[model samples]
Target: MTKGIQNSETPLFLLSMMMENPEAAELCFPQLLNNSCRKPLPPQSDGMLVYIVLSFISLLTVTLNLLVIISISNFRQLHNPTNLLILSLAVSDFLVGLLLMPAEILHTEACWFFGDHMCALNYVVDFIITSSSVGNMVLISIDRYLAICDPLQYTNKVTLDRTKICVCLCWICSVLYNSLILNNFLRHPDEQNSCYGECVVILNNITGTVDFVFTFISPITVIIFLYARVFVVAVSQARTMRSHIATVALQRSVKVTAKKSEMKAARTLGVVVVVFLICICPYYSPTLVGQDIEDSSSSSPFVVWLLYFNSCLNPVIYAFFYPWFRKSIKLIVTLQILQPDSCNAGIM
Candidate 1:
């Protein structure tokens, strides 16, 4: 008799559950619901809390990267070759916050409102931005390596004009490279999408492997090698400065100042490189484990957001380490930039 009673209550329990979540039964598009995507599964935790936290992150990313851009662009003293590379990085990070972060938040919705073309474009843009960011980092590594290891010719090799050209080329090549990688997906925008309202792109084993090598492995190898060389050279220079007692006071004073400036910049950039690799490594871990790279409903939110959170952290690192960056922030916030000859103000 008890078994029979329990069985009878099962239907009521299911009905209550359905009633509580009417959305669960509805398709993403109700008008022609048969082939449409289903709604997202309910969050395991408080959904409102999730939204508030993610929104805050998105806003912070934009705010911090914007400061980096404004500071570099507005202050003439900040317009050196190394800072130009930093400015390029800031642009990419700013876009990540402005565009990719919002799109990632939208992914939580689990049904894309934009049509298929937009979906392909979004992924392509994502790839281009990230690739360009890595390129900028590599350029920065090269700049520092030359400055420290080959200081005599560093000025001649890395000029403001040449850095500008390299930045432009980096962006252009990134677009071309990613567009090539995503050529097929752009051609068939909805090929990987399982449902009408879904937006997904798949990178098969071969394409994924190729992208991993070119985008991740090659660039990282170059970055590590260059920074290592820079580290050794900088250490030697520091030791030389410590051991040597110069007979000429004026010449020694000038040499010490220049060496200290270069070494400091090298240390700061090394921190940036380390933080970048930490944030980026997990996103490519699936490639290592032989998992298909797909943007789908089943994808982990942690992976995507972790990659984007790097951008926000870069500016924070700048603010914390670079006194000039802090000083520039004061000028920008206080609107002293609007005053005459503010761009000529000393930053370094």
Candidate 2:
């Protein structure tokens, strides 16, 4: 329907053909037709290098996030409502790095070896996790916004039960939104084509645009808006703090330490927001401009590495930017070191 496929010689008709016949493409396309293949494959050396680096980064990121998640979940002190949202986001990112990236690396090695069921499931899982991450980010923004703008009301409104319900709803909505792919377009299978066998349906251009808009563009907009508001609030607080410091400077007896504590909190929160935007924007922005343009764009190793870098940065961000999280990590490390001594004393 779009101008791209208007009169093309090798039209991308596989998606359309699969919609009409459930098992047509798979039955027709040969699995290993030597020399008859239309496109040339990448060199083994370069592809292997990509696989190795991506695999390493992905594994490292997942392990670190898992540790963060475990640390928070295990410790009673880390169970605050705000921290709960952070834990949710970490879990989602970890799953993306752990379960999804390796499978993607494998798919790049050969073809889509997993088949239709696995492919569909893969898409579903990635969709859910990515969506939830975005949703959790938005929720976190709102959480911070409220804490800044309406601390009193926030304490009353943001209860543990409400937070749990909100997370569950976010997951449900994501699943429903992604299920449209399976329900409408992905059902038709073309076994004739080797790659098309596990093909997920691409909706028409209008619907596809809507999907991209909702999934990527809209969330980014919301996050940017929240970030803007948060920045304004932070700037206002800093000015107020400066005014108080000036006033308190005259009072020799009242050495106000609260100003320093407030400034530290603001700095930590600011870093968290900035890092979240930086890491996530690269991954989501490319997916938003549409995948067609992405394919044609000159492949850069830096961009590829940056995509994986998003996952790798979360643990470091938490360790550096969040006071409570840093404290938790230190406590964990200290506990590990001290456990041996405690056991030795017990034996003696």
Top-lDDT candidate index: 1
What local distance difference test score does each model get?
Answer: 0.85, 0.60
Q: How many clashes would you count in candidate 1?
A: 0
Report the number of the highest-TM-score candidate. Answer: 1
lDDT (Cα) of model 1: 0.85
RMSD of 2: 9.8
How well is each residue in 219-272 modelled by candidate 1, as lDDT tens digits? 999999999998887677677788995537764554575587877888888999
Could you give the C-alpha RMSD of every candidate to the true structure, in order shown? 8.2, 9.8
Backbone clashes, each candidate: 0, 12
Every model's TM-score: 0.89, 0.71
